[model samples]
Target: MKCKTIVGLFLMSTLAVFSQNASVVSPNKKISVELRNSANTQVGGWYLKVNYSNDGKISEVFQQITLGLDRADQSFSTALKYLKTSKPNLINEHYSVVHGKRVQCTNSANEVVVSFENQGKSKLNLIIRAYNDGVAFRYEFPEKGGTFVVNDELTTYCVADSTKRWLEKFNPANEGLYTSSKDGNLQQDWGYPALFNTPDKGCWYLIHEADLDKNYCGTKLSNVAEKSKYKLTFPDQWNGRGQGEVKPTITLPWKSPWRVVIIGSLSDIVESTLVDDVSTPSIISKTDWIKPGIASWNYWSSNHGTKDFKKVCEFADLAASMGWPYTLLDWEWDTMGNGGKLEDALKYIHSLGLKPLMWYNSGGNHTWVSSTPKDRMLTHENRVEEFTKLKKLGVAGVKIDFFESEKQSMIQYYLDILEDAAKFDMMVYFHGCLVPRGWARTYPHLMTYEGVRGAEWYNNGPEFTTTAPEHNTILPFTRNVVGAMDYTPVTFTNSQFPHITSYGHELALSVVFESGIQHMADRPEGYQDLPDAAKTFLKEVPNAWDNTKLLDGYPGKDVIIARSKGNAWYIGGISAERFPKNKTLSFNFLPENVKYKLTLISDGEHDKKLVTEYMVVEKSSVVKVRLLGRGGFVACLKPIL
Candidate 1:
């Protein structure tokens, strides 16, 4: 009788452990995922199997992700229960479209929300949001308010064999050269949102995060655990100043940021709203004062022969002459040699009809000590007073720089500044920071952020070679797809370094790259030498666009894009191949009923010249572009009256 009683209890426990598994598919039936448990095995946890349809054919199987985490040294992976009630059409039930900062935003997908709990002495609950575009899941602590330490995420993503990846060689800083590698041959820990191309299956995948607010530490993929699987890893310690292997300490009832996996073609990857869809909504209810536009920056040209208030004002005057909205005073303006008083510079810039933007160091000059309670200018005690003084002094915005760490405190600082700047009706730009994970939706006062290896590196002769044309071509695919990239385009003449690209290549970048403030990099003297038609094009280039279309893009090779603002259509093409590439461009993408005027900016007959040709063309017109030696081309089609 004792043996029978024990056997009955064991049988019931076994059934409960593995009984709560489920499978879900996208409404369009293109993407699907299945969740199951392996509590009986050595590596016990919940896992996922994903399948994506490619070219109307289902690709090879992608497998398993251990969907769990350890909190305060307790495991939350086994002996789980699935409370199966879910919201499958969360997108449709909510709104379908939203206004965006860079591109047209859409949320017309479906979702499957499943809840789970670990049945241990110290318990935890989780909610998983599976979407057609991607998957976004987070942990929800049940406590009303308390602290919990997250040990690590037990997530693993396995790719198809022989896949090529366009990921950065990882350093503590994301400022590394991106390279192409095979699944079996990775060079280093990759950057966030690693882009992988599966040519055999004709599909692509992007791994990244969203809604990283309220002090959450960012994550990257770990080194390979097998031939094709990579686990989640945390950022390394910098200066012994942050939560080193320990993830953020959560004040509870806390929900973690979304872990997203976007799967599709390169075009779908570029147009994915997975970032914005998962982000928090606007916190500032009255955001009518927020504005995004070009600003004149003197950093790229600060050390060119002279550095002073007079020279600084020259750039401001030029921007005002072009009718640009702002003039951003870049680094070291507070103490640069011969750069006169800050008040005088602001007074002079405002007199020229240019709104003046000043710069501040988040970490207080060159000290490695982190920017927080110690940074006097930005301290909790003094920040409001300083910003109020700037507001009264007629300063338009502030470009804060060097957020050198990705700790929870640094992330909180970003939100803190955004919130404060909004209160004063002032906008901001972030430098040396993480890429946008849809923070713009929450804080419209945040104009742009520089997380890319931008043109500013050209000031150092060796770095001119580093920021290659190929790097520019890859950005529109990997970095710019997620958010605004302050690449600071259009430097006509190279000063301290050798400019390897042709004139047309620089011209096309104005169209290819996306930014709220499209600061032109060259001095006014450079623009003084441009042809009349080229000057007109440069003026129109800074306007915000209503839409963007990626026509042709190959990783680290070439790309062609079409962007529209109002009635004008701007087409830009760039080639980074060793030899010249010639391609035919069709105007059929234009509206049929309207007549148009086309302005083509292409390579000139001589190596040192750029030629612009203007003409009227029909929708059927097809033009050829001969791109040579890291060269490029641009076309502006304006509707006829």
Candidate 2:
């Protein structure tokens, strides 16, 4: 009976191992997770291991094969065998150690370390943050980093297939993975899941997909000089992706351990978890140097000619008179197909008090400019030269248009432009681009990017009648969390336009949306004809703010945001579809014992006209308010002594 029981137990254990789809291979020693696609194909995998002291303290956690390699070579086959071997020597040279307590491992080439701490519940909190334009990850440690408590790593590994194609086609090199086939059987390269590694205490290593071309890759090390903070080092020969016509695959397989360190008690880990749920990336800088201002001509007005220069100047003069700092000399002014001269137009724009920003294409291809002069077009090598010319032309910034979509190569191309622009003190605003993922902080010169379905669409038709109202409310929670949005606000009034939401809602958007360089999206004639009180509010409204506070409302219903600059606060409130007749707003964050003079813009109580009312109020324990129907409100408050 005892012999039979032993045989039965062994059989049960084998089944248990097979059933575990994703789990820690060995608690406190190794951690791993496997992922399958919707088609049930094993597409990706992740693994982590830790070595620790006898007193329940971690010495190191080795990352063997966090993200599996593509089926490209014999080296990958050998790495798979090494993973199963679980032998100490099979582990790669990349391993991270924290003092003598804990260690981590990975094979990634680029790494960023933000902050880490310990939470008392036998868990250590590890935050693997990013300084570039990518996502971040967090890990939980058990018993002073003795055991790695992993949740799910599969979500982080899956790269959108479309993003890979975007990278290849838009990359300046023009090398990619996709091939045209009507039958849809094309040879495409799959993106590898990103990996992190720390061999010793020198620096953190990050390994990720270089671009759309999966053949070539590189790694970057962070925080090499210091033990506590981040310093970066790059490989001497490690040229990034798309460097060669026929991309060369790395000969060596990644077989290293990714590591993170914790200095304090377990309580630090618990505290870090509070922010773990706030998963979206945050902006590092607000693009203050770019100066939040207004632009004159937009996509619709780009066709206006030299004959209309006087009219354009009149608009620019009005924008400046209304306290706007900059105006745009959009397309057609370039003399691309026409005989217009850029140098001549720039001279006239500078004569006005407003700064001039011109439009350019990423690939130097515009609708009208069938054949661009070789010198004007942007190539990788000559990008610096073109930027220098624009700077010499006395342009404050350049609007790079028609990126089309979010592709890996296009994304990298944008980053390259931003890096170059910084060298010349030039600012960039991207059009037809993807949502921001905190790149503005790394490169402060990246003024703005257009990913939102903004005011420009209003010109296409009345499609906004179906979605615009809800889109405004949903974006703040989703896109705004990532970074600043260039949602061009304040379009012409509904009375004149007679399109989507009310004119009051448009006025409210000026306050609701956040942009370093905000656009007064309507024609100057739209607001110029309104009463002095309405015109004064638009003229005095500032685009940038020191701080922002969310007062009330949800995704699609309503939202109130208060922005502050010095002693003044600007409150903007918006409601979708219909305005609340008797909305009561609470001001709990206002300073106590201070009196404020408020300038309010709201819909008239009896008349249908939108009016600006002035009132005085004190910041007490709680302040109350009311709102009009389809009506929005904007109030400027000055603190009185």
Candidate 3:
């Protein structure tokens, strides 16, 4: 048979089998579902897919299945238990559909609850709930999962409350732009606006998983420009199961997990009730041996080849004087198999009152550390001995480099390294690796990872100018939401020349970006001659924080972030270009009835040749202020009380 005919036959067979076990109990609410047995041969496995209206306003979708043995065991176990027992105990059996209009739906196994109620002229509540193991909170619409012709308009709904507000509140014109559908042809605002509010109402943590086939997961939505497709992936640490494959061999039948989207306006009630029962707050591991503080050399630095014992000691001394705690000796320090002694470098770094960190490749082709080593080199026995030797040499941390391909085998390899490193009390920094997915919480000594596009590219060439802005903006919302990023910050104003942001903007990033060990990404000489004001700002920035708040803005246009370490508050804001009008910043999270001393760096007046030298210090009762064009600001605030 032809390919199209084969696919049509397959889908027809699958749909017919699905229809036998499925039905739409609520057609007006657009809630539909199907369920089958684990051994069902027609579709190759037992499966269920539900597309429903959530809380009357949002439309959502969910899919689950038990296919082959490997995936079937786990998927079937969870699905069966949820359908049979867990869900029935949790759902509110009787609830009001609207004022003076009470409705009751039968409670049954594998049933998903869908309800919609008109709230006001422009607002509605779309709710979907499964008493069993599956559940999701989302914002859905009419044309969901369907193709749209060009120039079509779409309406989006949200709960009208304070706890959860849409991104449109910040930029009214951009709201609902992310949800529109688009044809194969390019056009702007093809997607819709989406946000997720959880019981954990602090920062938005997003997980995106792309399969080896490059199939993107997550909620399908449009972008403001309406030219692209966007999807969010479920958080899977093992990236499914087995190496290079999502285990269980199940096709589309398995419901991976709910793709959660929260309308912030109704965050409090929704987060408390709608989030999946399986989702929980992260649990961070204990780091008994690893110490947290500033570090000297990062993965990419200029002073590598020329530094001898004397120069190394001088740099260590400078770092010690600055109240920084550690120093690093990166790649090439070891001669691989030629026998370089790590003791000599460790001794000198320690002599300067700074802890020492060394670099090693996780699994590479180098003569010293090859993935497929000849003789005893590739075995775990030999690697453990090498790690033991490094530990004796006083190495506090090991920077593991170059596990470039994120395959299942590589994931296992890194997990093994983290386990072995823990045995020797050595901390780890992963380079050329994927973003952290709460790994730091599981292995605290895994200080940071280099999945982000960081400062190293800036020194290389022109690509830095184009990519840095969006990368910086999206990271906090996506990657950093889960854990720390080892993005080396603070390249001096002079080093970046004309392409860089002003010194103040650079200075502010130390607080804006979240990392465990924030490296001073510039050379020692870069900050040596900076003004005293800028110098003081750099010196006092902290690497860790007790809390962080995204005050306003989005990925590309602009972003403002505030973090607190102890009593001090460090705020940083950046813009893509000089805006024609001023933007007002709000500080609603600050403690009320208290005065603060604000020291700010912004655009200089006409006379100041140094564009970054502008400073403002004032006592402020109101936490709102207007920032100038193309202008960014960094401020350090200490409470006057």
Candidate 4:
């Protein structure tokens, strides 16, 4: 019996963990991760040796992947919680599929789940899943009696000190740039859709969050005490004024959001749906009312000069003329009501076949509304009343802004608003808030999140303050990968000529950026004055796409991407921050057998002007482009008979 007991003990620790070198490959065997425990001399609690397989070359990307958790009373943590954890038994695992309903992306995917547990009475489980696109895992605390306080959740993604890191500040306002670095040095405790570039080893990993609900407050990643490692950090606290320590008290059987790591080439990272896949399935059973498309915005042009019903109607007419679906009424016009002005304007917009998206401050912001903004929507009843009134007025969507807090209370408010908005058959856009972490998947009506330093920054000043070209280039892999971004791109005006990235570069943003509700921030006159090629793109560009392909480029530098919808494809390319003299692209992403008419909207001889070209291209065709100082290009390809 002693002999039998020893044999079982050895098997329990060794079998579930496999070995330090042994790993599990993804279903397609493209991605693999090796697991090992510190009990066996691995430094971390448990290490993940991740490898990527491209063209059959197995490259180890992440050598040390481990995580830990801590509590307030210091009673438990991922490090010591598992110390008394014994038997490390492998529980049952399986494969599953999640469908994206009412969205353009449609597919069936394979997912493999691996679960493990301690055989002792106190059960602390760790579960990991290897999807063809990426890998994700979370801790499971399953005891059921009462509440507990958690101090921290430590997730470490270890990379080489020499690796490239695009670090972003943890501004709750979501306003900042992705300054590049080598040692992962950050000015503040920050988190972003951070990109870790180690191309030589064949891995460009994107770190982000997914499926975050009320269970936990928002999390951002910061550097660990040890060099060459990054760990998860939460807002220190929470209240009305700004972000603060999150109340970590929670009920039994809680889990963390899937800490996601997307690996592959730049294209693979750009086209990943891992965040969407791991998110909660759609809560709205009937989603036909949710629509994704472009909008004409008013904030950029100072609410179209005089925020009245007449000026708003002019913008609505402009939207209809551009074949766009919505016109956003921003500023005090939507909130102050302007003496029943918004109601009249929205009704007129609907008659023109254009929807009206009104803007609102997420309570307690004295900036927009004048009186009783507090008494407006402080409860469930208030939200239902507001949404019901808007639904009756035929308002299609709302842009709620200035959340500025990452507390659980604010997070819960977001869920409550989304639920209430859905009941009224309205689409939603959240601004001045958390970066979208798979909320679009859960609340299909949630179209976009303006957690990006997008075009709105242009309002801060003249040309110099405008959204920089490099910022646009780096977003696809980070912010765009996590979910739809409300960048409010596409500005075509001659007044901002001196500071503008070339006209072609601005045009290219249509294809390069991904958002459910793409907003045109330029003035109405700007749209009317656009070259025919620009107008054509404005009408044809899609807010949601069936597919996306990253052809080539680097982070904070030049990038080219192709996005498709229905039968046509749109491609966007932008120069690096410094702006290049020119760029050349291959039409290889197009089907080899399909002949197509490719129209290129490019920079004119003068950087300030726009030029367009048309050609019939075969599979072998290569197109050379000139991008003078912050320039870019946008093109549309349609298969021709």
Candidate 5:
């Protein structure tokens, strides 16, 4: 009788361990996510299986999505009861932004909220959304106003070992190059917006997070447990100058940020607005003052140019000559010499009808210990005082630098500055910062983030001379897909160090990189010496676009893209290989039966020069272009009117 009783209890417990499962699919039925709550699995207590449909052929892209919640009070990771799933609902909305890859965007997804109860009876909700482009999910604690301590989040993603990935090593500032590998080896930390490609399945995936706010700490991926599995890892003790805790302490009734997996072809990865789709909409009501345009920056040419009043005016003159609307007065404007003060430079800039942007150090012991103009933007009172004075002086924007941390406090600091800046109608740019994760959508006044090893690195080291070409090709697929990246591109002349990329490659960056304020990094002399056609193209490049499309190429080898502003289209392409590449530019994306004039600027026989040609073409025309090793090209298409 005793043995029979023990056997009955064991059977009941086994059944309870793997109780319920649910699935959700995209509205188009192309992507699906399946959740299995099995307490016995090594993937925490819950795991997800994701599949994608290509031409009616289904393939599994993700094997497991480990999920759990550890709190100081209780563990939501084990022995959870599945309650019920809400009916799938469609969310389709359209919105416009101040500046981005495109002016307008659409957010459409099919969503379902799955409910659960932990052994301690604490309720948790898992909300999943499936879009044609990707899948996103997040956790929610619906309980009322009480405090909770999140010891850790046990969310990990597992994929097949054969998949190729371009992952950047984890850093607080997110300023590292992406390493492409497929050796089944893992790193202790990998940054977000990690790109993966499954050649056999004909699909691409980019993993990132969205809707991140002050309530939580930023996270990255760590596959130290298993090479193919990457779990969510918080910031290390060294980050934020070791000032803040790695764990997040939050108030109740809070939903964690969405873990977004962008899935599709390379085009889908490039053109998808899935990151913006999952983030919060614009919180600022008045966005008319926020404008996107090219800016004449002196830092690339003379890092301390602001100290010389003549140098400041030269850049302002460059902006005026190029028909750009703004000139950036880089750091040290506070100590201006050689015939002008801060007010004097502002007056001169405005006299030329150019808006002036000033730079500031983020002002903390956390980073950039030696930079000046520090501590002016660290608090609300300081920002209000500074911004009020700037607004009174007609300063258009503020470029705050050196925030080298991803802790919850730093994240809140970024938000606080944005919110405060908006009140005074000032646009903001962040340098020495974390990669953008959809904050541009939430804060329209936020212009750009310099979280890349961009042109400025040319001044710092010689390694960029060789690695930059490959890095530039990969960014369109990885970093820039999330938000505006301030690469400070288009330098025709050398900085302290010379770039090995060709003149045509330099010209193409003005189009290839998307930034709210595209900083033309060359000196005035460089622009004056450019061919008439190339200079004209520089003047016509638009910072904001109406539409964008990825035409061809791969991650590290080459890339071609076409972007439209109004009725005109701009095409940019670059090659990263040591050997030359030949590509055919098919205008099939153009309106059928329409004639257009194409102005093509391509690499010359030599790397230092550029060659320009003009031709009349239609939607059916296929123009061939040759990119020299480490070279590029750009073209403009306007309907023959």
Candidate 6:
């Protein structure tokens, strides 16, 4: 990490009735955050305002910012005394990741810390950082060696009521559809990573949090929002079956998670690494054991195949045939039959040179599921015992599922699992869980999370058949904007329920969705029946990307994205409309004056088949393509030597 002092500290008299304000701008000077000590603290204490600059003109993106906290004894929300503001520090650092939208990332921002004293003379600090792509802030306690229970957080984001927004209704599992709204008048509770498009501002921003640890509980935007002001609302008391307190109890010298608002153009929102940039860096120094790859998942197809050892071996064979690295053994592997026992299945999987990822149910009163391998990951001792055993059994990772609560204890449970899994050098994928808030950066082995309404929903009901096409198009801008999402992309065959999306659309998901361990949710036969070109593309496509580019399109209507790995680039486009959509591929993002081989895969005459074409291309080349209604396409570019 590198830092430079940009401005000297300005001290203020520690007076009870003082008026003071401070401001910090991004390195590029395109965004600024202003904090003011309100004269009338009763209404609120230390309000904030965020502004964006365009062509030397300034405009407010967030109308108002509310900050405060209520402790068991003291209230930091209002009637506070003002202290000095720290010097502006330029944070210019670069970090690399194991697997993400990009391999290289930047953490550049200008930060300021403002101190204050509550009515009881207790000290509080507000730390704010302004980045070119967004702004973030968090509260800190300067005192040391004490414990306190925070009854409430008075922080809030005041978006204009007229602003267009895409918000998902709140659910413990964080699995729900994002509904488009003209304003914030719909649901009182909405999930994090909400999307907004400021009217006439040409700016797009996503609201979320980063660096969430065991000390803090996950939060959501509550319609407690008056005048379109969305306040931070804690998880329900019933969370974790009423296990732990919703409010956080913390030791002194602690800081709250960074509340982030990523702002910029659509491309900036899609490609920005601000979430991970602000998160804690990787704790694991040796990450070569944490390999990212495509996994052949059995649940989406068989759902109960782990009980049948023969069926499990078939999928293992399928993975070996596809040249993939891992095979996920879903629930009920404890009751295996046919091909001997769990040990025999592991022997067969290892014989095929593939690492196996086993599944576990996060047991407790929190979830109602009756799956086996339950109660094995709830406590620290249990996780240590189980992870140690799995490590001895040659398991590469664990897909712990059914964690449907977000209370403080549950948050701690999630982190405990990640930390313990790392001790065994095993990767992790969280299912039936909250959306990732940059945990991957903190724990590199924390590969992916299933917090979206993914393909598994197709087997749950009929709604997904009709809703999935539109849902697929909206995710890149909404759910996927925050972190790695495990949507389990690309399935051509139907399970207990059928999908109406075209074969090409299914193929496009391999490139459209970004997951450290991208699970191919199809039967072995489904992949084997594909054309040679399509099969070759699947065999070579990468789950981890070097860079990502949002080429064109809109949410719910259509989308086109290009991702690169080494000298090869992969492009994906999907359409939700009922009619064919035409798009022109632009190669301008490629290396200048470089020739390449282009392999294009598009929807066939019908939904069941796909057609592949080959061509020569370069940086200046433009190719026109069409997608069938409720369909999609995938293309690959390899720089010709």
TM-score of every model? 0.90, 0.60, 0.61, 0.88, 0.96, 0.95
For each candidate, the alpha-carbon lDDT, in order, equals 0.71, 0.45, 0.46, 0.72, 0.89, 0.88
Candidates, ranked, TM-score: 5, 6, 1, 4, 3, 2
Model 1 agreement with the true structure over 76-175: per-residue lDDT tens digits: 7765655553545546533222223234555545555556656654445545555666666666666586677777777777776688888876554366
Per-residue lDDT of 146 in model 5: 84
Model 2 per-residue lDDT tens digits across residues 58-158: 32323232322222221111122111211112211233211100113232212222111212112122223212112233332222212111211221221
Better structure of 1 and 6 per lDDT: 6
lDDT winner, 3 or 6:
6
- List model 3 lDDT by residue over 352-398, tens digit each: 77787776655443223342222221246756887788777777887
What count of clashes does model 5 give? 1
Residue 150 in model 3: lDDT: 13
For 143-204, candidate 4 gives per-residue lDDT tens digits of 67666777777677777767888878777776788778876555356667888877464778
The CA lDDT at 439 in model 2 is 54
Alpha carbon lDDT of residue 430, candidate 3? 82
Look at candidate 4 and tell me the lDDT of residue 420: 83
Error of 1 at 484 (Å): 0.7
Off by over 4 Å in 6: 1-21, 38-44, 56-59, 225-227
Q: Enumerate residue pairs that collide in model 1.
A: none
lDDT (Cα) of model 3 = 0.46
Error in Å for residue 231 of model 4:
1.6
Off by over 4 Å in 5: 1-21, 39-44, 199-201
| Candidate order (lDDT) | 5, 6, 4, 1, 3, 2
Worst 10 residues of 6 by lDDT: 1-10
Q: Best candidate, TM-score-wise?
A: 5
